[model samples]
Target: MSSSFPFPIKPVPFMYLGDNDRNLPDLSDDEFCDLVAVLKALARSSYPRLEAVPLALNAYNCNQGTDDDGERPWAYFYPITMIPPARLDEKNDLLPNYPEIELDFEVCQDLKRRWRSIRYGGDDNNNNQSMEFSPPARYRFLCFIHKHRIDRKNTLQKGVHTISIWDREWDELIWHDTYHVDRISRRKDIREFWRHVKAPGFIDEVDSREHFMSRIRYRTVYHICEQIEETLRGPVPPRHTIYAVMSTALFHMNNARDLQVSIVPDRLELFGGQHKGLLPRFFAHLLCLCLDVRPGWSRARQKRFVLQFRILERLQWMRLRTREYLELHDSDRDGEYRVDAKKKDGGGRQWMYEALNIP
Candidate 1:
């Protein structure tokens, strides 16, 4: 690690040089030392290419498994790893993740702040929630990648800038993680500030923090939705588990349930409802529910998914007045509301006779 770096100390890189690269045969002791010599020279100075950090992080650390090795997202020195395996590039929804990186972000201060700034984070806690964040809309992005080994799958490509994995090994890096990161950065202030020009804080200061952070949170949801649409290379994204994404986004932020809703738009376009605008931010609520998605959300996402099958299903479960409203309606005829227009052969229109007989 060099002392003359731009930011902090070079994060420690977890060392595990073994048979990570399959195509290239295992390095001979001499070759290994040569490679190490080259890397040690590079690490002796500053390499602040922030643009390429995440890719490196993804390749070296991000993945789901034991955190013993710093290979987790937080502890990578050099970014390039062996090329990802071939089964990774299957789809955009499944962002190949290095669980270590993902977990690392969860705890790092700066990275945590950055991640918290995303729409997914705004729905995590009620204490940190505000009156300005918009309820996230429901979306459906595919999850086509999930590998047995995510670490080795992050590297092994030619280009250092864009995703540069081999054609055959493209499927090895889960596209979902990459897609989301790319999509979110598109809405950032320094990089993609223009995308948020019409968002909550685009105008005057709504509240104290001038609503700056809140608006950032608001734009995140939009970014997520739009990105899925674009990155999935589609006219529309696939049907995700509905509330699953919404809840996940909110879980990241630590926001309140109802308070965040105050800021969230109430609907989303699921499949054919893109133009109708009847899509309620049930997706937003899903986020509120996902903070503890383990067992708590056991039924929530499923319930939201089922509601789309029938409108009445939702109104009944979430609304208290549905049963009362239903009881007042006429069941004998095809009509679905309170009985008042029934006119018999005897002439006059009739109301519920039970109420009249109340005397």
Candidate 2:
């Protein structure tokens, strides 16, 4: 648990996984060096693993070909450490008798606090059963809490704790989240691969980079945890909380101005569990599957009613976000999604938008 101040640093490999030998927008040698330095920072910070710790970043249209085209977006990664749950006595600071757990803080503060409180009888309020239990079953308890939490529904808010980088980019900050699980990769498992795009096989050096970016996608952290649970013996977990953000964000971020960006108040919420209520379920339902990429999509409509809860009229976040969205269009849906199904399914739906805490 003890680490030196400033976390005295070490450089890591940043194998550039793209094609740079072809026609790019053109960059002066000086600009290239600065850009490479920025990229180096990205590599150093954002290392990916084939396991739960893999950091998959969307480095697309990142440099705008070269320098001659326009202002280039910069790259950097956020390194994270995941902590294991707190210990049995709760007060006994062994923290599950493991070495320091390293994961995104923002995404999972609940584990220990919930554990500590349950073990110590702190929270007077009642939700799940009182936390009294033995220490040896920490992982089982973890599985229990995760399973029960998701089966319960919109009761728990905030989100899984995460350490993320909010780098400023062209009137907005484009970013990614990393959950470094501190495990090594076998690399051979395509299914184990995270934040990485795999092609049928290798390509010409020039085209390899393009093919790689095209394959970038997201997976639920639970998917990662599920894999972990499977690695253990005895009972496999019933289900893990992938949380809406993971599945929805590819479970990653993309721009709609071409699929992404922001936040605000006036009492608002957005996506997944936003004020949309039934709409959130609607999205959750779609996202829960839609992954098969099979012809069975035609059967999709048969289950349409699965998500058909009546809309909660004028949901708070819906109204607030809608207003903010109009303000961005200077007021308009851009008639984008209306004409094209793919566009509508993707970028067009986010027709209007803005960041709250908007400047």
Candidate 3:
């Protein structure tokens, strides 16, 4: 006989079941078919009654939390087709269809070992109950994407798309005592139970106004001031972004900062009522600095400055429109008046041309 044994050691097929499998060089048609057959067999053997429908094969890079060796794990996306476990309904009719099962798999060497060693569907200690596979990180990500898409589509169909604010703290406060209350006690003290409860410690009247102010004032100068300083360090300051500026200003006001005067309850209501809280005050301060307006200016002068600003804004918009029209005319001979018989010509275009004194 030959010096070598009849069978040589080979890498476990399950370990290579990922996107990297596509990069495997020059396989004949038979070899490719054989590989797929092996994968199908492995999938079927792993989970009885489950059919593996391959979608995509790719290597998944695991983050620091998931990866042990920093090696990119081979990954595959497949829909595991299966019927729902039989359940008896009131009418004794089985639900015909269930939701599709999609899974992202990371092909790992350890997984192959675990797969082989673990005995499934038996009284043995190594049965499926005792041994289970930890889901890949991408599995959660995929689930989130599916859920988000469904929610977004449903929300869009309803026509009102807006960010929803959830006051978790307030919600917790409402339910915290109510959840533990005995039924009889709750029924007896229903009104007083909800109404007599004290507000949150931070906003409670137990603390003197001066004490509250002092506490919030120090917090603002320390925490908020440091954050603002850090944000202003980069070449493009965070304040340049409108959202960032608004958020920073809001944070300061929320923490009861003395921007000019103490942000008392009465002052808060006054500023917040018609102007939607501290935004107008913050905006006014910003505008003053930008326009180099003095703090001592009279209300009449301030109104005049605002009027002038509005006029300047209108002029700027007109100039922009004229420039855009000239550029479009130079680039295209037909400009906005391209011949399309199906399209209706409106008076808006004629009005624009007349207003801009364009032929």
In the range 1-359, model 2's lDDT, one tens digit per residue, is 01222331111112233233211223334433333332222222221121222222211222122234222222223233232332335453333222232333322322222222222333322233444331111100110001011122332332232222221111122222221221111111111222222212121211455443344332222233334345673322222122222223322222212112322111212222244332232222222212111224333342342223122334444334333322332112233211122343435433212111111
lDDT tens digits by residue: candidate 1, 46-76: 2223323332222222112222321111222
Pick by TM-score: which candidate is best?
A: 2
**If scored against the real structure, what TM-score would every candidate get?**
0.18, 0.22, 0.17
CA lDDT, candidate 2, residue 228: 39
Measured on C-alpha atoms, candidate 1 has an lDDT of 0.25
Residue-level lDDT for 190 in candidate 1:
19
Q: What stretches of model 3 exceed 4 Å from their correct place?
A: 1-75, 79-94, 99-112, 115-154, 157-359
How displaced is residue 314 in candidate 2, in Å? 30
Q: Which ten residues in a row have the lowest lDDT in candidate 2?
A: 138-147
Give the worst 10-residue stretch by lDDT in candidate 1: 165-174
lDDT of 2 at 44: 28
Total colliding residue pairs, candidate 3: 3
Better of 1 and 3 by TM-score: 1
